[model samples]
Target: MRRLMMTMLFLSFAVGAAACGGGAKTTGADAEGKIKITTTIGMIADITEQVGGEHVKVTALMKPGVDPHLYKASQGDVRKLEEAELILYGGLHLEGKMTDIFENMAKQKTTVAVTRDIPESQLLLVDDGSGTHDPHVWFDVKLWTRATETVQEALSKHDAAHAAEYKQNADAYIAKLRELDQYAARQIASIPEGQRVLVTAHDAFGYFGKAYGIKVMGLQGISTASEYGSKDVSTLRDYLVANKIKAVFVESSVPKKSIEAVIQGAAKQGHEVKIGGELFSDAMGPAGTPEGTYIGMVRHNVDTIVKALK
Candidate 1:
């Protein structure tokens, strides 16, 4: 019922955007000569802005702490999408509910997925047997470099006059991402191998674990939309007690109660599991803060994990 309602709502928004006067379809740029780019997640928006420099204006539909897996585009979001000359989204079902909307918008304007260019060999398959890979590629900084390149490629294709500038900007951004990847690897390596387990609210850290060589366990599955029950908690509790795991982490987008419940369950079993710190899984921190940026968010997570488990 919820999916059906959201789909209907999306259709209405699409119709309304077309019917509204003076909301004429935006071409390459606005009257100010800046390409209007709309992105689904802040991470993509930040990269677009960095690559676009002064030639493009970017707005993100999903804000900090927003869980993109369950996010449905609002009416205002539809208007933004309609007005955008180029739209960039995290693909592979990251924005699960808005897939149809993005598809419809693509037929009208330039819509691209940052993950479209990422190789399938690098993508981790979701164990759900759906034949779909995990969408949390951003967790691996090196893999995220491809997303930056994708943004650059899209911008270059849309506005060829600024292609050189886009390439220059993307090159600089990729350098920083490479450094961050190295830092994460070095820091995570400092933790004793036996104590390198990372338990979190969900399985969003699969890429992070794979990239940095840490064991990751989650109370819930890849998508938070998946339900969790008492069995899940009890099983995690036993795992924590048996392994003598010391800390778990909460997520910025997911409710803390689930992790809290796990803590309580561990306590009853005579095992203590402290929350290492909040990790930016599906979403980054608030705007204007360091954590709001992709590099800062990854650094914060790396530092937090190293502090707790090392």
Candidate 2:
């Protein structure tokens, strides 16, 4: 009788263990049920959150003010990519260094290149005759509205049940972008024709100038990773002196020492130029601030340019 009791007790303990294991598995599955997404930059992450609403969890690989061109992913980033249900990236080589890795991941997961939908004609090509594409499509509010719509479309495909919510959020965001575009037009108009020339640390503003009717000159090229040689500095200083450009701008993501050298060169040439406010070029502002969001970022940039140039 004692032997029979021992067998029964062992069976009961085994059943309890199986139940506990099943409960743990169910909890993990529940956590995974929430859709996980990853984006290349903070601005793209913000837009994805707006469209995904509470149904999705999103992570941005690049931090605020980090230069994406030179960003390299770590081992932890590989885990993030493996766990993500979908990945969104700004194409056109904005994340130049990570492009190949992302392309390989697309074969296994749902990867959407948000800027790929924009037409080539609208993109400003590099004038150095290298046929290189300009990756700064976000500078134009109108173009960015289309990019946001592409994101919404990709999200709808991933979660059809939440399509209506995504569309509603996208429409609201696009309306805000339209308002920002109009505001930028008005603010830029406040600057006089000759004064509209924007001299900055790099050529990142080419698309912005094209869209807003301003002449943009940069001390460096498209990629901030490259050094601005003495020849580039001399050319810019001469232009500033000849055109009498008053305000030279620095990018928040770039080193200020290079830009200050330009100012010093101008001074030696008998031209007075001041450091305009730091502009958000390659990255957005802090996560919680107004300049953090896409529309808010453009609004802040426009306000800064107008206030400085005018």
Candidate 3:
């Protein structure tokens, strides 16, 4: 069943790509000395810029609010991959459907799966009897700090002349991540224990729940393609009613319908719940917003959760 679904999804994406004028061509670098770095998401691109500083030019394939799981690569993206000096991507199958393309790119380019460097023991598995690693490591500030270090090390190795600069920038970034971690802890602690239940559209917040003390409930599983079964809806409605959960959240990248369904279900069960502010889950906010950067993204999520639940 899963294989059939995957095939259908891929075919749809191919059809869409063909209709959208095939794909955009990758523009080559104009300058001779600049190192070209390509990242899968804007968050990764922002981190690479921090580490590479002025020495490298970075491009991100996925824009704000685009789910990486459903992201389709264009001809332009392929060209960027071909011309890149270094390619950085979040690993653990966060790119879901794009995993095969990135695996092929690994053979030809200096590709680094930033999240792959994280130790297996520290990662949480999203097993539903069948085992799979959860790819949302960025939800935990400490884990993301480690991932950032891995990215810096990779960049420094590739560009030895600016190794010192990359290392310094990474250190600074790591310190900021630590501060964010502390802040998140403090903010979440302010929410009463029972009210700390975090309900969202999908299972992206498992790491966030594990990092803090909240209990997270999602309508869908780790993959966006995972269908939300009636049993899942019933189970969540029961939990919300039993705990009197007052707020649930929708993700920017996911359709708001799933979360609204949860609210409706809760109401049917005689529980009153409101839609908490939309949270940046699989994607960050718009470029100029506070949630645009990795740090800002985490901070915004923490603030939203705290404000709604406390």
Candidate 4:
């Protein structure tokens, strides 16, 4: 449905923009001697910057607290995409509105999906029975290591002069990611075995739970757009009651209403569920904050969950 809408607007928007065109001004590395990379999500942009180091400049389309599931490409964003020397995005329709544009760009641009480096077998199938793989691979640090590999290879391929530097940066970044995974394991294990359940606004953490041994429950389905019926709320409320769960989390990019509703429903049935600290699900934190970085976001989430649930 989103692709269909983008298709209708693509030709008109492209033509109009070209007719009245003065492109975005280049700066920093793009002005100097570095590759200019544009990405759809902060996680992708963060990895690109880390792996490419001083050899690349990255511009991310979606900002903090922006929901990528419903994000549309603005004219400025499209111009950035057109001007970039390379493009990186999460695949599996994570950027639902921009999928078609990315597909059309492959012929003329160096567009890469970071998630493509991971084998399809390792990705989780959405519970919607849609036959589509979940796009939140970054939640699992080990899986995210695959994404950094693609980032490094793309940077090296585009700038052969800096290939060795890119590889070195990638190696260092991968080591940090492994350490992050171990930290998450130790923190997650701190929660009592009887209270090892996580409830959140949506199913963005399926991979996180599977990777960390926490049982995750979301009030809504994989995509936030998936409708939840009265029965869905009641079923989760029952789960909370049966398991003696105490906290449900809200996502930075998603609405808290659904999770709040679960909290209310749980309260009605004698289980008082508190709002766990916000988790950076579809997006990262602000630019300067610790949660803004991928590793920092993971650490914050682990610490938050453990403090609240343990």
Highest TM-score scorer: 1
* C-alpha lDDT (0 to 100) for residue 237 of candidate 2: 87
What overall lDDT goes with each candidate model?
0.93, 0.86, 0.87, 0.90
The lDDT, on a scale of 0 to 1, for candidate 3 is 0.87
Q: List the residue pairs that clash in candidate 2.
A: none
Per residue, candidate 1 scores C-alpha lDDT tens digits across 156-202 of 99899999999999999899999999999999999999999999999
* TM-score-best of 3 and 4: 4
- Scanning candidate 2 in windows of ten residues, the lowest lDDT window is 23-32
Give the per-residue lDDT digits (tens) of candidate 3, residues 157-260: 98788899999999988888899999998999999997988999899999999998789888999989889878888888888889888999989899998888
lDDT by residue for model 4 (1-310), tens? 9999999899889888987784766632476877878999999999999998887879999999998988999999988888888989998989988989999878878999999879988999987678999899998999999999999998888888889999999999999999999999989998998889988888899999999999988888777878888898899989998888888888999988888888898898888989989999999999999999999999999999999999
In each prediction, how many residue pairs overlap at the backbone (N, C-alpha, C within less than 3 A)? 0, 0, 1, 0
| True lDDT of residue 61, candidate 3 | 94
How well does candidate 1 score on lDDT at residue 147? 92
Which ten contiguous residues of candidate 1 have the minimum total lDDT?
A: 20-29
TM-scores, each model vs. reference: 0.91, 0.89, 0.89, 0.91
The true-versus-predicted C-alpha distance at residue 129 of model 1, in Å, is: 1.2
Higher-lDDT candidate of 1 and 3: 1
Model 3: colliding residue pairs:
24-76
Query: Which is superior by lDDT, 2 or 3?
Result: 3
Ranking by lDDT: 1, 4, 3, 2
